[model samples]
Every structure is written in C-alpha cells, then in structure tokens.
Target: MPAEPLEKGQTRFALRAPSARRVAVVIEGEAHPMNRDPDGLYSAEFGAPAGTLYRFRVTTGGGEELEVPDPASRFQPEDVHGPSEVVDTRAFGRPDAGWRGRPWHETVLYELHVGAFTPEGTYEAAAGKLDHLRDLGVTAVELMPLSDFPGGRNWGYDGVLPYAPDSSYGRPESLRAFAAAAHERGIQVFLDVVYNHFGPDGNYLSAYAPEFFTDRHETPWGAAINMDGRGSGYVREFFIRNALYWLSDYGLDGLRLDAVHAILDDSPEHFLTELARRVQEGPGAGRHVHLLLENEENEASRLLGGGSSDSVYTAQWNDDIHHALHVSATGEGASYYSDFADAPVARLGRCLAEGFAFQGDPSQHRGNARGEPSGHLSPLRFVSLLQNHDQVGNRAFGDRISESVSSEVVRAVAAVYLLAPQVPMLFMGEEWAASSPFQFFCDFDGDLARLVTEGRRREFQKFPEFSEEATRERIPDPSDEQTFLDSKLVWDERGDLENAEILDFYTDALAVRRAEIVPRLEGIPGTGAQQRLVGERGLRVQWPLADGSLLSLLANLSEKESGGFEPPPGRLIFATNDTGPDDTGNLSAWTVAWYLLENNS
Candidate 1:
C-alpha cells in the first residue's frame, strides 16, 4: 500500500486500509487520490481547509465508493458524520505537560459533565472553576465523555469521532487550552471514552469502512464492533492508537473506559489486557496513567492483568453498594430495588472494608450467584460514591438521593464514601445540595426529537411512579439555554447557611481521611480476614492501620441504641454525628466520631 495524497485540488482525506486498493479524499469542491504510507497511515493534504464539510471516498475489498470520516479526524459535520475538519491537536496552546503523577488511591475525584458544569457550558467555562475543586481538596477531575456526538449537545455516549473533542463543546483549541489550564492548577484530568457502539444517528462508518463491524456478533444497540473477526488486527490497532493519543497527544492523566463489559473479544489474554499494557507504555505512564472501567459484569479480570498500570486500575465504581445505599437513602420502591431494601449497614460496611459483596450470594435480580470474594484486593481499589450522574439523570425527574435523606444521613454517607479505603468520587452540586435537576437532556433534529420523546416514555411505562406524559415532558431540550443553566453549580450560595454547613462538613470529613487513614491504607496488612464486632445496634471494626495502631473504629448506626466505647485514653479528635443545638452541621443521623487513641502502656 502507498500513502494517499491530495489529487490536484482537494481539502479532505481518508485513512489507509491495507485491504482496500483504492481511496479518495473529498473536501468541499474537489476529490483527491490518496497514497498509503509504509506505516499503514493514509495521507492527503489540502491547499486550503477549514470548516466541517469533509467525507472520504473509500474503495473496499470489493469495488465500491462510500464516504466516511478520516478515521481519526478532529471534528465532523453535525448530521453527516462523515469526514471531519482536520485539526492540529497541538493548535490550542499546549501546556508544559509536566505533572506530578499521583497514584489512584491518592486522588480525590470530582466528576462533572462539561456541558452543564458551568453557565457557559464549554471547556473554557470549566477551566474557570478549577480553583473551587483545588480548594475542596480535589486532586483530579474526571470528565464525562467528550467524543463528537450527533447534535450540538449530548450526554456524549453516542460519539462517532473518537479522536476529536466535541466541537459543540468548543474548538480543538479550547479543549487543549482547558487541559493546559487544569495541569497548571496541580489538578490531573481524566477523560471518559465510549467504544461499545456507534450511535444510531450520524454513524456513517458503515458506508466507507465495512470491516469495522460484524453482523456475526450482536449488541444491545446493534452489530458488535469487529474485534475478533477476519480483519481484527487493524481493528485492535484503531482503538489502541486512540487510547494513546489522548494520553500522549492530549496529555490526559487518565482514561475512564465506558462499558468495557460490552466490549467482547476472543483474542488471547483479551483486548483490555493489551490496551492496558499499551497505555502504561504511553506518555502518561512516563508520568503515570490510571485506567478505570464502568463494568456490569463485576469481572475482576480487567484489574487482574498484572500489567504496568499504577495499581492495575486501582478501583472500580462499587455499584452494588450504590444500589444498596440508594435504596436505604430513598424509600423509593422502583425498578431493580429488590436486592437492597432491608440490607443492613453490616453488609454495607463489609463491602467498604472489602470489595465485592453478593459474593456467591443468590441474587434475586440476577437470578444467579454473583461475584467472587474480593478479599485479596486492596480497599483502595474500589471507588464508592453516594450519587453519580447516572443515579440522577436516569431517574424520571432526576431527583437526587439527598432530596430523600436527612442532612445527617447525607453527611454520614459522605463520610463513609470519602473516608473509606477506596477512592472517593463526587457528582456535581452534591457537596452543596443544588436544587437544580440534572435531567436526561439531548438535542436531535425535529422529527428525531419527536421520536426520542415518544420512545423514552414508552420505555419507562412500567414504573408506577414514572408517568409517561411527565417522562416525555421531563426530557430537557438539549439546545435550551435554560436546561444548561439549570445544571450549573450555584457558587454564590457557598456562604449561605445550609450550603455553608454542608461545605464545612465536607471539609472536616476530608481532613480526617487524609490525616488519620490514608497512611495506614498505603501499606495494608492481612489477606482475606473479616474483622468486626457486631452489636444489637452498633458495630466495631478492627483493622491494622498501616500508620501504627490496631485500630478499632466503632459506629452507632441506630439512634435508639448506645454502647460503652473505651479508648486507650488519648485525645478525642472529633465526633462526627453528635448533633447539638448549635452543632457545626454535625447531626445524629449519618454522623462520625473520630478519636486518636494513644498507647499509654
């Protein structure tokens, strides 16, 4: 194969596929022949190129001309999803790229949707808010997927262009600028990416590149991507290069892979295993690269590769705990609420102390046994959170769990999540209890909008509380400035009474975790040992603190019961839930009491 070049007058391009004999690059007014380079890279340069009206002319194994985007183009047209405008990824002023790489457990993650993170809702607006996260003790911010979606606004799961930051979010410059600014604040940035399925609309890859997917395999959305098919070699290369591009070209600190369980492959060791290896050898790994997954299978294999990852993806989102806690927090008896209700705090504590609950337990929802005992993995390997974006937006009205629980319970739960052995993550506005709802929002063409509105209502019709009419009505119009406005964090309310109190509680809780617990967790001891003294209304957990003491921190989960707690008679550091008339946001429900026991012996 030979590298492709612009035929006389052309402003567009296509990727080199060794299997394809002929290829053409089509810009606005002209089409050019492409030559493949020795490295299998397709090349076509234009005299003048600027906007998004670009598509490829690809000739596959069989003689045919179909249009597709430059496999890794930076920006694509809104509706066409064909070849996109070529961008100099380094065009947006590149940062010094030097960053202090922090380990997975060492990071405090703050998750935000770029579209709704600020009133401007672009990458630039988010850059302005880095100060708030820095002050809140956040060392990293994990962004929702930024790949190019169909319309001007989306949740970003239906991305078609993997190489580019969504043009709707801003230009390539804006994204690179934001990355540079974030690094300057001593904050690492992680990007979430989707590869399971190409979206329904604006997916034109099938037109030009037939080998990218396989009808032999099935996915919930459509045909599974051709990972293990005849041309699987290039297929793996396509995704692996994208992973490294974000880390090397974009200077990303980490990647949160969306729906890895859906990415099925029969290759030896697995694509995930290979992908993790390549990323660790990439640029971020020179600094360091953290890999995370949103998995439904609870498969331990992704983290078990023993690859060069900092801690083999230090943690996964603990959804079973989230489900259990959500059911306990909100009395809402809705879908998938079966396994949780009435599940004791002991069960929750066991999951926190160790990862993976439902280990061989008969799950009524799954109709089978679930999970192996995660006894051997470090506690820092599972990230636990009270509320994330999915828990909110996926709801009919997108009600936050805070709406149901008392402030005390919220504060207490926050303590368990932030102070626990695993990494802690926070959804936007959760720290201050913002009233604005983060509803399911999207913008599609008019007829497609009607289809989406109608389709969404019919899907959730079974839930008694989920009204079809209201569900349809609740889908926020993505283009509406008001919808975006409703989601921004209200920074002004930080000094108000209620929000201020929530802020103080969060700050104090964070202080305790860093000061009292982190060191002990860094060098954990024992393998597969359960330590707990259960009482009628309280529980005491005894685990060796890597710092010094054989620590036993007891908690009273029930207000109706009390017990005697004898320490080594050191200083009482802090009491979390002791709610007084003039207490500083410390309440009876969901509270913590801290102590620094001294060895007087």
Candidate 2:
C-alpha cells in the first residue's frame, strides 16, 4: 500500500526510491521531506484528507530532481500523466452486502468493454444495462481492463496505473456502484488484469526505483517485470497486493490474468502460484473468488481441482476450440487458424470431449509441440467462447464473427457452446449481431501515436491481402479519435426484426442450458467423454454427467447435408434448425442438436 489513512485525520505517504538521495511529498506546491529507512523506503505523515492532489518529488544521487505520480494510485481523475489523488477505500459503501457470488459451473459470461458497451461509455450507464443482461440469462459480466492509461481511450492493454480505474469511465465509486448493481441482479462481475509488463508510456518506476524492472528477461514490451532478479521480493509483493486490492477493496468477484505466458519468471515459487494462494487465503476465504488465466502455453497443470472450492484457478480461456470453430465456419485458414484447418470438425470434437484440441500436439504456427494432456481435467475447467475482444479487435478491420458467417452458422455455433458442459462466454452485441466493428483504437501523442499507427498496419502486412502498400495504408489508424467512436455498440440494431430473432435464439438456448444442463454439470468426471466423426464435417460428442445421465451433441457444421449417421439417442433438448434428422439419418447443413439420456443405474 503506497498510501494509508491514519488516525487524527493524518495520511501516511510512502515511496520506494532506492536510487534517490532524497524524496518529498509534493502537495499544493509544497515539498515535505520524508524520512528514509534502511531499505530505502521514504515515509512521511501529513494532514491530507481524501481528494487532495499530490505527487512525489525525488532528488537523484546525481542531483537531478523529478516529480511523478504514485504507482499505486487508486484514482487518476486527470488521466495517467497527471497527479494522483488521495482516496479512502472505505468511503464507498456497497449495497449488495449479501452477494456471495455464483459457482463456477453456473457461470455464463458476457464479456464487454466498458467504453464501448453503451453509448455513454461510463460505469453508471453500464450499470443501467444489468437488467438486459439478466433477462438474457447472463450469470456473470466480464469487463475489459479498467486500469488508467495515458490517453482518453484505449483497448486497455496499455494501462500504466494498475491500481487506478481509468477516470474516462468514471470515479472509483462509480465502479463500486456498477458492481453493486450487477450483484443486485444476481450477476457476478469479473475484471481483466494485466501483470506481464507496464504500458509503453507514462510509467515512472524506472526513474526512482530502477530495480523494479530488469533486462535479464525480455518481453514484447521490452524488459520484463523484475520478478526473479535481485530486489524482486517487493516487486512480487507489489503485484500480489494489486490483485488483493481489486478483489478486497473493489469487491470484484474474479480476475482474468491477461497473457500469462509472457510473464516469465525463474523463481523456485512462481509468482502466479503465490498470488493465487494469497488470494484464496485473503478475500476468497468466504465467497467464490475465481482466478482465470489466458496462457497461450495451454499448461493444464495450472488449472487444477475440477472447479472445486479448493482449486487454485477456476478455468482458462480455451482458444483452441475458438480457432477450430472459426476455421470451420469461415473457412479462413490464415495465421494460427491454419493449425485446425485440416481437420476442424475433428478438432472441435476433441475440444468438446477433452479440454483442449491440441494436447501435446505439434503446432504449425509455433513450429513446436504445444499444451499438455488435458483429458484428466473436467469440462468446467475450460471457458469456451466464439468471439472475445482479441478475436474481434485484433483483426485489421475488427469485423465480428457474425459478419463473416451466415446467421444460421452463427446460431448453430451458439447452440453448440451455450449448452455444452464447459462454461460459455459471449462478447458484447454478439447475440444480436451488431454492425459496428471493434477496431483497435488508442489516444497517444505525437511520435508514439505515429509509431503505434504504423506498427498496427505493419502487423497485417504479412497477409497476402495486405501485401499491397495501398491496401495496407487503408487500415484504420489507431490514434484517430473516430476509430474509437466507431467501435461503440449500436444499441438500436438489437430492436430490428432480423437482429431480434437472433437475440431470441440466444436467449432461448441459454434458458435451456440453465434449466436442463447446469444442474447436472457439478460432478461430471473428465474422462468418459467421447467423440466420433459422422462425416467430413459432422461431429458427435457425449459426456457422462454427475447424475449418471449422458449429455450428447450432434452437429453438421457444413453448408451441405451430412448423411449416413444414426439419430442421436435420448430426448432432444435443443436444436438450431426446426427440423430433426430424417428417416434416412441425414442432418441439414449448418445444424446442431443436443440430447440428454437419463441413466437407470
């Protein structure tokens, strides 16, 4: 904790500046000297109440002086480059005191960006929409990162202040209100957090505390966090405290760690392991506090306990299933999608039965073997999604998956995942198929802005369609304000007749899941789930549930009719199309059906 409120209306301010000869707290243009301890931690107590603007002025050993905001600032009212404000975490009161959160097996996630979720793009506006999500049967709402960034708008991966909620959305109290509102609607709130590296700009840790980062380990953003180097104890504690702050102070139900593979560490006890353990012992001791990961490595070992109360992590974002489904529906085999293009239906079946499609299998994209055997992990250990922020926003045009495939194909894919044993997540506006694109957008100044624009265009140059200079130049500039505005969701589109039909389809599928599937998902073992191919593009998968019942899926994922398959056993639970299998055992193109068979044993 960088700042703490003490008795008698005094505040204790602390900063770790080992390389500085002297450090002072600068409040209202006055410099108050702080006492330095043996470990180079400077501390001082002052009579400062909440909302007092302040910064730290440090004099280096060479006699140069500089000022910077607190690294653990709770709120940045004027954005990342401005002075931090004093915030009392206990000031805000939560209305939903009895909210203990939902179980992992009952989670139906609806991922949304706070800035693009509504027309106002504020936390208050987002809270007003909780009723809509509850009506659509969303059990949880997963928000993209809200950390303070350098500019007015960003995808939030470039956050610099880990503790502060970006002021562009609203005050910290607004976020608490948003969570309370969702809890009132029986919706758990989750946040996406980044701990791999600091953002490219507005980070001042290297100036006073150079040991905060190290060149021994490198990442895409440059030198990795000093998690294993000398003076790493405090660095690890810094991140662990940040995680607890969000969970305890803000009352967030869970956290989705972004890109954990890039968090390279050589310590005997990995930072992730220690962080999860601390969280479980701290705020998670009472309620369900889930910890999720987005590791490209597909390390199933990290996801343990089959969604049990004692598990370190609840689930992981299963990208293998997404890629396989994307390739099968869109027939676009470019980039990483090529890994599943050869046998997409087979891969999809594998993901449905087992946890991952590539369990220790060779990956063409990485030129190496990827993932461990995930067959022993329960289906509840995986979170299945068709489109997330990365899947839609990282593209050159940021086109939603609904735009590339037919509505029938979209509905079929939805039915397959929404009713499956694994947890299902939907990107915002995916149910109604909005027309707006979630293009990558940001607000940076001058040279950095130009570099970001050019870097984004350069990333797509390897593709054949973007090989031409003119085509590449047409790519949207991330720094343009219009790029951010254009990504906002069009709320009116959901009311249109065509889009409403799709919304109804999604609503009904989720209703069926809640009523029929979620109750039986608790004790389903990882093994005994089997997959058999009906034809080139047809898949049949079955899983033995906890109640001794067998849940099944029969999907024809092509544009042509698939024949020579036996009718699925048991009663039909849900189907994408109106018609069922014919007497000749042929399913219509782009059709999916789910069935349930009660066990007499």
Top TM-score: which candidate number?
Answer: 2
Query: Which lDDT values do the candidates have, in the order given?
Result: 0.67, 0.90
**lDDT tens digits, residues 340-369, model 2?**
989998999999999999888999988999
Candidate 2 residue 253 C-alpha distance from true site, Å: 0.3
lDDT of 1 by residue, 166-265 (tens): 8777877777778778888878889988878877677656655567888877888788988888777777887888888788767778888888778888
Please, what is the TM-score per model? 0.87, 0.98
RMSD of 1: 4.4
For model 2 the local lDDT of residue 253 reads: 97
Q: lDDT of model 1 at residue 16?
A: 51
Overall local distance difference test of candidate 1: 0.67
| Top candidate by lDDT | 2
TM-score of model 1 vs. true structure: 0.87
Backbone steric clashes in candidate 2, count = 0
